[model samples]
Target: MLVIGTTEAAYMLGINCQRVRQLLAERRVKGAYKDGREWKIPLYKKMVDIIPGTRGPKGRWRHRLQARPTYIHVNKHIIDSNRNRRENQPVIKVDRAKHSKYCHEVEITGPCRVVYRPHQPLCSGAVLWIEVEQSTRVITKLYG
Candidate 1:
C-alpha cells in the first residue's frame, strides 16, 4: 500500500484529483483516509491500479496557470490607431556633421531614419536610432 494524497493518487491512477476524492468518499481505496482539515487523504498503488483514464503531462515541460483578469484591471491598452497613423508620417534625416543645428525637443516618430557618423549621438556602429516612450514597452510570453 503506497499511501498518498488524492492528487498524487489521481496522477498514479491516471485520473483526476476530484475523482480520486470521490473514490475515497465511496471507500474505493481500501486503506485511504482523510486525517487533517483541508488535506490528509492517502492512497496506495494497488488502489490506483484499479482506476482508469490518462495523465496530463509526463513532466516534459513546466506549466503556469493564472486566472483571467477582469477587463477593468487591464495593465496597459495599446491602441492600434497610433500604429497605422505612423505609416503615413514623413521620414526625418540629418547629416551627422550637421547635428549641431538640431534641437532635443523635436517630436519625431514614424518612418524617420538617422545617418550616424563620427561625433554623432550614436556611440556604437549603428547608423539609425528611434525614440519611444520609456513606459510603453510591453513584453509577453505564451504557452500552447
Candidate 2:
C-alpha cells in the first residue's frame, strides 16, 4: 500500500504528469484517491490503458477528380456528329441525365489520345475528343 504522488506515478508509468491527473479525474487508475492538493496512487496499481492515436488527418479523406483516372463527358449531339463523320465507327451512347452526378472513364485498348477543348464559338460545342488508332477498342467505366 505504498502511496505515490502523481509525478512519481507518471514517471513509473512512462507517461506525462498531466495524463496521470487526467486518469485520476476520470477515476481510471485503480486504488487512486485525491488528497487536499494532489492525487495519491498505490504503487502496485496499474495505470489506465492508452489508446492508439489516429494516423491520418482528423476527418475522412475527400475524393478528388485529379486523384482518380481521367474521364470524358460527351453529349448526344456530339455522338450524332461523330456517327455522321464515320459510318463504320462504333459509338458508345451515355445518358447525360442518368449520369449527371458521375464521370465515365473511357479505356482504349490501343494507341489513343484524349483532347480537351474549351467552349469556343468557332469550334463545335464538343468539350472532349478521343482519337483512337485504327482497329482499337474503347471501354467506358462510370464512377460517381
After TM-score superposition, the amount by which residue 131's alpha carbon in candidate 1 deviates from its true location, in angstroms, is 47
Q: TM-score for all predictions?
A: 0.30, 0.31
**Which segments of candidate 1 are over 4 A away from where they belong?**
38-144
* RMSD list, candidates in order: 20.1, 23.1
Count clashes in each candidate, considering only residues at least 3 apart in sequence or on different chains.
Answer: 1, 0
Per-residue lDDT, model 1, residue 104, is 17
Positional deviation of residue 7's Cα in model 1 after best superposition, in angstroms: 0.9
Question: In angstroms, what RMSD does candidate 1 have relative to the true structure?
Answer: 20.1
Q: Which lDDT values do the candidates have, in the order given? A: 0.36, 0.49
Model 1, span 29-133: residue lDDT tens:
655556674434443423443332256534321122112211111111122432556432222222222121222124323233334344554433333444323
Best-fitting candidate, scored by TM-score: 2
What would the per-residue lDDT of candidate 2 be over residues 1-144, giving only the tens digit for each residue?
577787656544544678778767867677777789977777543332332335644422111111213233455654577578863333443222113222345566667676676753213355675555432434556543
Error of 1 at 138 (Å): 31
